[model samples]
Target: MSEKTNQPLRICMISYRSNPHSGGQGVYIRNLAKALCELGHEVDVLAGPPDPLLEGAARLIPVETLDLYNPEALFRTPRLDELKDPVNLMEWIGTSTMGYPEPFTFGFRAVRHLKDQLHKYDIIHDNQSLSYGIEKLSRKIPTVATIHHPMTVDRRLAVRSVRAPWKKFKHLRWYSFIGMQKRVSRKLPKIITVSEFSKKDIAREYAIDPSRFSVVPNGISTELFHPMPAIPREPGRLIVTNSADMPLKGLYHLLEALHRVSLTHSVRLTVIGKAKEKGGIEKLIKKLNIAHLIDFTGRIDHHQFVREYAKASIAVVPSLYEGFGLPVGEAMATATPVISTTGGALPEVAGDAALLVPPGNSNALAKAICSLLDDPEKRKQLGAAGYNRVHEHFTWKNAAEKTVETYREVIRDYR
Candidate 1:
């Protein structure tokens, strides 16, 4: 074992799929790796497609998979040569059966690659790829995993979102990988979660002891998400960063609130995501007759996203539940007052900086947005408060330092 010294530690971080545009996992990996490198540590990110966008001291190692979920191909069959690998074959079969296979297959490939080079790093940190292969890796190396939140929450919410038995069954099939995650999580010695709320929920859901967990709150990239004073804020223009049709994101409630608010006010909504053509969100939009009042920006770069937040009168996070509520912190970091539901760790992230509303309540959300829009003074106060709150509690530097501490502790115990 290498002795601890003033020298920086070599760390390897793994994520199954890390595309910043796809979701927060990519953002987390990109920023966290940058921060860790800034702290004088060497960091390498091993990820599958779509590749994560990383900078600073971090190096990206592409762990190629079948990538059956690529939007361009959209379930295109794999070539016969690719199917020679058992992991690739499994991934193709799993996707064919409507089950997510990235975690399992990615872990298999990652472990195989790392086995021969285990001596190159002092510790391994996994970004929620809780697979049996990870369990096998942990037995040989000092490994720690970050479970953002239990996928069981997503499964439960998705199952409840649809009424038809077939859709619910499909939801169950898609989340079958959760069974593997649950089994693997219990065997790992250290687990890092983003909030106290998530830590508790994961412990209960996975039936693991709370002592195995560490609550390290995620940080917003202040350099990117900070206020753009040059961009004039638009009055009566509400903005939300949602996953379109995901039930856990609570976009349905936000649309309903938009409908209610637009009845008497001249409010227009800009969604920072695209909706499926025939998905639940699109159907709801047409049914509620609010298609003309909303604009979906599809996917935008980080610069455009920050500008969008700066231009909005207010930012809303209407999630049914969140593991950390990165969107809430990002909006707050941009000096935009937020109206967020007290779902999961949202209130924890929002603190006293945001107007809290009940989850799945369109009426409450509408009222809160209207109240903020009508009172510019209140918006100013909340916005400033939120900015201060983020500066004090959430920063990449802080998260990286705390995460390194956990890494050191794990390394020492393993030795």
Candidate 2:
């Protein structure tokens, strides 16, 4: 059933840290690869620490590195046998100095892996580990990268959120990976991103031509995120699935809006992610005296998360910026009315289905929540509209088709 490509492409997807439980990129690789394989294309995923949660037939090629950020064991004790390589010692030193050497190291490992199997693959698709060694791989094979968004946005926001000057400086130092990404991005022939907003932002941030980028919006897992008709809806409860402690997620702003909403309305906020102990969100909830009104569901499974979405009267996405807001689409897939902010690519995802408000404006968020809370008809309408929008515009099958096309294009051009 493989469509007639110029040639059969053995495509490999690369990810630095592909933990489905933790972040969006891992979910993207898993879903996209599975979709591609269903279309009769051969797909393999090359990944680093926290291995991917992939489906059938798609091979997961894990390249083990020192998972330095392991919560239980911060610094992994190196085996004397493993330490025989001087390069490993160098890597350890490089990482110890607070430099993010993993991406570069992973790229080196990937290049070595590909050296023996270079003839097998027609193209190499990178999942945002834009390292110097990655640029080297492009020299050998046609390479395409998917930049979800510029990391500079996260860097800038993290720096801004840090109250202490030293902490801000350390944040800036830690985000030095941007320098490598910017340099390597300009040389790449084709780049994929989830939104037009991301395309423009990446162009400016990396000083690359906007035309070089392709906007392929991410698809929601409609099957998994669909409405559970058996689960009864919870009235006056709002749901939002954002990383609570991250300033970039705008959880503090959502909390502020929730505080205002609690003054007159008896509503509760169920945040899907946990607020870190002594983190900003925990501090703010105490400050606003809305600790009783907010509920934190720390990293629940997909079934439970979707059930929560189905039960809630409405969902809110109060992110400061999103390259592609998955929660909005997921909420919509469950037929939940959404109130999302027009931050970064959020509007692109929310469209006319959800009520859009300006980012960082708690008053506007509170007003939107109040309006949805007041009118059942409006909520129902929005929910239906959102579901329709997601069904029509975003689908995993479509994303896989376009990605397959891109692979063929890159391979043909490589020849």
Candidate 3:
């Protein structure tokens, strides 16, 4: 039943690209939109290539792009006519030059797409697409931006991960858009982020005022992630969501911990993601000789995810940093005990429901895993605590309510 408001809001939620299974941005868009709709608001998600799935009364408005980085045809050259459009040409040129130009180009494309309907939306919420074109929209309408975290962190971590001079240069070039983002974000009236840790870090890195940010945490999908009381837990089983070779994910450290755990216990790991072709993760598995102990579920639906969590003895999130740790919330929501690091907003999310270890510490992770494996009663206790914590604190309805509060603030403060 819709919680009809005195005044229903029309919101334009924009994302440059929102592939549902790709990452957090997609999950965020899908869940947040539904929650807003339930609160008696109309949400039109304006997104680019690789479409986003929507539930409830929220709608999707797709703006076509050259999509040079489409996984099906990554970095493919556009035809002469296709590149005739200035936006397409710029995006193509930027990609060819070892830079990511989608956010910048998507801004212009979004501008064109929304020009006819500018007055339809009460507020424009940018999902991290802080481009100059987005800045222009902020000037015309009440606009708010959600910077999931600082991309500057990712850039630094990525550049440091590569050894070769050229690889470092390429990584640096890819993140050059950060300069544009910082400028655009500063002009916006309000910003929403997932955690206070993100608010401080992004302000420090992007040079934006901390006062502009409202730390509204992301919510877990309890309907999808709740405990499966019917499925029996598998002994010595661990599950982790993977981000391939990204050093910031700290999967490498987790692999080391897994190897260490296997030496002392009968352990098996289930990865809810794929390892890229010849990627660092694929090579590392062979290096540790732990392939036989790990199962990679390339892509899974919500049902499979719940089943996997239901059977897992423990879930681990070993990210070196996270804007907000969704994995921690997901595990907890599923009534699975969690082991997370003191990385970024992880501890904020974990609270006291799970074990906490130092980021990038294999020995600590192994120790935590071993302790949980040997103590079933402790695991059960933590699992129930996590489950209780998620329901009591993190829910889409709450996140949506807080987000709407921010929306109203931006609307009232609009110049």
Candidate 4:
């Protein structure tokens, strides 16, 4: 970092999609933007559909696209007028062909939107939208990217989960954007990732040298996720935040564990996200006859999320892989005991504060859940430990400081 550059920076942050209040990525945008603003930096977030809803001095620069994947009208064909823009045509074509081109289209749109405004910012931070247009931005200005985790991990998991050759092909097609991301990632001068595990994995998968990476662990919002001691934890009430059908989330394994545990002891699961009607998850729940044992809370705001965590006996993160396990950190921030699988960087987030189980092992998950449920004292201890751990190690203040350091490094290297 340049010692002379002590003044706050004008930072432009970009993300192809920020899912508002849900998902780790949305939480990431909202918290990171607010924290950076609080740190005295002039931060402007350029984000795509559903709005990042960033708070504080940070500003939102809406980068609108076709928004083809919006749930309300998912994959609807663009009108002829809308398709006049080459980018919109490309987006519709990609979606119609079973490929996800949001990041690519978003980058194109963002670059066009930012071209006239580029001189107003000191640095640009690209949030995993490793598109060709993003690479173009790097040549004109100092640019950095944050690859939360290797998309290869998600692609591989999705492909492996399907047995049908055609289904496998579709999974490959949907994740074709990974190729563009990999190529563009190599062109960036700096890459910020969420965990040491993801840093190494992304470095290898994207074929970039590890030296180009900076590992900045994400911060959990203590205000929204903090413990409500007034709320009584319900025994056997487990909570998980995930789209039930996503293979990478490992919700199937969690459901299996829930079924097994319910055979001996009465237990219920509260999934924070909804399942598609008659989707894979709904079918599986019917097949396992555990539909009665689980409930979905659909979309929820921060207050509801905190209340859900507080009321649960334990929070669970069943992801088969994560760059950084946000669910675990959130639960810890809420002083909720957590049971997570040792997949990817989950163990790193949980540390010694939560019970660990092997990924894809329903039997192991069941055993761990049973043990925790049977011992309230152990649950209470783990909850407190997790709370302390998050406060000490995973606050946004620490993350923003490190992030600014990375920003300064990029600026200096560009200079």
Say which candidate scores most in lDDT: 3
| Candidate 1: Cα lDDT at 114 | 92
Backbone clashes (count) for model 4: 0
Clash totals in order: 0, 0, 0, 0
Q: Residue-wise lDDT of candidate 4 within 1-415, one digit each (tens)? A: 1246788889899988888677778888888989998988899999988988888999998876888878899778778999999999988888889999888888888889987999899999998889999999999988999889999999999999999999999999999999999999999999999999999899899899999999999998888879999999888999998965879999999999999999888799999979989888898899999988988998888798899998999898988999999999999999999999999999989999999999999999999999999999999999999999999999887889999899899999898
Error of 1 at 282 (Å): 0.7
Q: What C-alpha lDDT values do all the predictions have? A: 0.91, 0.85, 0.91, 0.90
The residue-by-residue lDDT of candidate 2 on 303-392, one tens digit each, is 888888888999999998999988888889999999999999999988999999999889999999999999999999999999999999
Query: What tens-digit string does per-residue lDDT give for candidate 1 at 1-415?
Result: 4586556889999999988765778889999999999999989898998878788979999888888878888899899999999999999999999999899899999988897988898888999989898899899989999999989999999999889999999999999999899999999889999999999999999999999898888998888889999999998988998756889999999999999899888998989878988988989999999999998998788789888898899999999999999999999999999999999999999999999999999999999988888999999999999999999999999999999888888888887
Ranking by lDDT: 3, 1, 4, 2
Model 3: colliding residue pairs? none
Candidate 2 lDDT for residue 95:
68
